[model samples]
Target: MTMVTPGSSPSPDPDLVQTILLSLRRKQGTWVAWAQGCQTLQQAKLTPQQIFEETGFEPIQQNQIVVAEQVYQSILKAGLSDKAQAHFDQRGSDLLYELRVLSQADRARVAEFTLKHGLEADEVRELVKPVKEYSYRKENPPGFGDGPGDAIAFHFWKLARQKDDLQDRSRLIAQGLRFADSDGARQQIETLLTDFTVVKEQPAPTLPLYRLETETDLPRIIPVVGQMPLTIDDLKAVPVAVPENPFGMVTFSGTGAWIAVPGWQVIFQSEDPVGLLTRARQLPNYPAEAADEPVLVIVDRANREWQDDGYFLVAQAEQLTMHWSPSPIDAPILGKVVLILRPKRILDEDYNRQPWQLDE
Candidate 1:
């Protein structure tokens, strides 16, 4: 590995820079290894000033060196001009400061994008900056859930993932970033909701179903299909037990209590959250499905005893995005209607069901 020192002229060549930066990790193993060295020298009675002066290395936070080297590598891969390269070396610490928020996996991905796209070092830093909530109703496209969003509108713009008019919808949403918030640009926000893939409901759940029985002392338990627009609170409260196995859950059935249903993963996302609960309350109280034969019930708007029209359920199937949970309360709030897999039939002739995971 090449020696890199302060005030030394750094190479502009992308390949050379990447090689030297990559070697930092291999030789030192990880920033933690360097930290261990610091502790060891101190244990040997070396003073902090003496250690830095003699050993020629200062103690660094875990991943600090890793992040520094990573920044150098990204700068090289970005193929920025010489001035930009110098800017990166000078601002290396700032880039690291910005990257502090990313997980190891996500930080690596940002580096990968830097390498792939040849973004300028500064641009690369800005690209991974986490997007906070920027609400633009009607004209806005989407908000990344839970985790931070990438600042690159191009990144999310590419999420259209299919060829359709929805591509325009995505582009329009991205537009909100540049134009929507500006004066007089509010009219440019696209009000038309893009139609994602229309979900198809299978008559039976794809997985095998074991009867989930409620305990005698507990409240009556019933299992509802995800096609029913149940909220996150409702799904978590579904009498499914804390799973002993990845595919196991405690549930209730008419004939027994504390029933164990294997091969079911409880997961969720909210698509049409506003009306989800309202629809659920109006649902016909059918035995969720026949015992031993789980069936799919797409919970859109259902009619109960009423003479009303245009009544929207607070929580309904149309608002769901994705849900695949085994236990309960663990489903991710998807914030909008997407698609959910309702496993109506999760078992077979021999009474065994291998859990099937549906990637939403």
Candidate 2:
């Protein structure tokens, strides 16, 4: 054998070493290099081939040494196994299984813990997007015992008693009336009666009393009037007209002023023939005194030749010749002439009147 050089170092490729170690760990069910292999190497001072032989690990092929060197460098970059060991310890293999098997009590405990840690269930559920349906159901389980209405009534009654004012108490009674069933209404009424009765039954101081009159008599009375009969001729004498110009003068002659019948005219030798004929159709009757007066007349001169006639009398006036003007006229005329008549104030007269009666 040739004499070997002392203190000469051999360069071992890191990739080749890591590949060998990884194969050995997989086959042996452990990361042997990082655990037993690295420890043995530090203590024994053996070459890679010697270590493989001594540990029963296979030798890496010469062609695969570069791949092994790459893997070895990666393993070194990933650091130690202790960090991984700590992680596995904290989150054990059965974490998901534990969550799956959790009871209602366990879920409540989790919810409480989350709340204590400032992680609200409502907020978390909103964020998670697609949460398991069962989780939501567990969080909001159905309530037990008495319905919501009873709780509401109890709180309302408590608040009413705290206020202790009569109006407040009355309002509470009204609210109870609105919500209560027949039996509940009766119960509430009885409760109120019992409370008030207790106060009334207790002894109390007396106050001064005053006596006042409570009854008196009052009289009722009605008035009476005498009746009078009227004839057709008397009714015809009443002044009535569908006035042409309500404010303008209406003049009549012959029997025109004495009869209330419509349509009569004055016959004067100098009068316009067309105007007289029109007037004959619109006049209201007046009495003997009015007949002697100069008649007030409204002229309808709309038709250029006076074909449109003015109002006229139905009957002949005995002696009345009336002249009317807005201002004073000479001896035969009058100023501001207004026809005055006593109104017939009979109730239901229009309803009772016949067609012939209207003409009368």
Candidate 3:
């Protein structure tokens, strides 16, 4: 086996180095004997002489030897011998051998070791104070009645919902509502109510609409279809005019409003009839693929803030089908008005659910 040279940037095995250092630190007597008997001290070719000269230290002085011996004795007295032995047994012995070769730096290393492992009286107090404070907080949680019991229940409910447990979701909602009724939980209750209403009211469309090109050889005129409920199959069968070049041409209404092209699919119907009509006038294209079922179309009458005031029938159409036939101007479509009314019983039920008047 080749002898490994020290301090030569050799690929030292970390585990071997740890093991050696640990072993050397543990067996103080063995380490001292090895240091005294080191025949290869000169061959180690260390910077000890240069360091000693720079520091102006007399290497053979009796006082220096006494100081070194006292420092080692102090480390031994601090029970470092047993601790170092344990570290060596657990790690390795090469590290201790390396430490022994560093004569001047060994004193600093010993001082560091003592500081790390040996706690002063003040250090012990510093460690205990925070732990005591934490214990107090645990015993007394913030807020009044039952001390964080409801908060704990809410946390558990939330954790349960994350696990996709429907039962836990319902439980949490119920618990949260109850907590809201409590004097201390009113603010949290109001926040939850706002979130529920916002989520429920926001409508997300499944199909996207596209823009229609006017000048392209593709069909420029799309038939203004009726509000009649037509399935996707019916739409597919409806003949459309296709342009030749199919490029750069955009479709627009007489009033400068951009009409949705015939190709896009209709994904959702607005509950507001006026909003639907406004949306229809603005769409330029439709979705290509849609479900085969006809969706409900409401003639939105509530929000009419435009100069072109009229009813709009919204539906999904293919994105590439250029020409629309049987225009909205036909005689049969002009004379009819479709009204969808809510049932009287349903209206009455909603009315009954309303909050009581101030007088009552």
Best by lDDT: 1
In candidate 1, stretches whose alpha carbon ends up further than 4 angstroms from where it belongs are 1-48, 58-63, 66-98, 119-124, 131-140, 143-151, 154-360
Point to the candidate with the largest TM-score: 1
Pairwise lDDT winner, candidates 1 and 2: 1
Q: Over the stretch 121-152, how does candidate 3's per-residue lDDT look in tens digits? A: 34323322222222222232222122222333
For candidate 2, write residues 109-218 as lDDT tens digits.
Answer: 33223333344435433322112222212122122112222223333443344444778766765554443324553364437633742222122122111111111111
Task: Point out where model 2 deviates above 4 Å.
Answer: 1-145, 181-190, 196-360
The deviation in Å at residue 86 for candidate 3 is: 63
List model 1 lDDT by residue over 181-291, tens digit each: 222222223232344643232221232112333222123334664676778887776565343221132436444433222222231232122222112212222244533
lDDT winner, 1 or 3 = 1
lDDT of each: 0.36, 0.31, 0.32
Ten residues in sequence with the least summed lDDT for candidate 1: 130-139
The 10 consecutive residues of candidate 3 with the worst lDDT sum are 316-325
Q: Give the TM-score (vs. native) of candidate 1.
A: 0.23
* TM-score to native of every candidate shown: 0.23, 0.14, 0.15
Please say which candidate is ahead in TM-score: 1 or 3: 1
lDDT of 3 at 95: 28
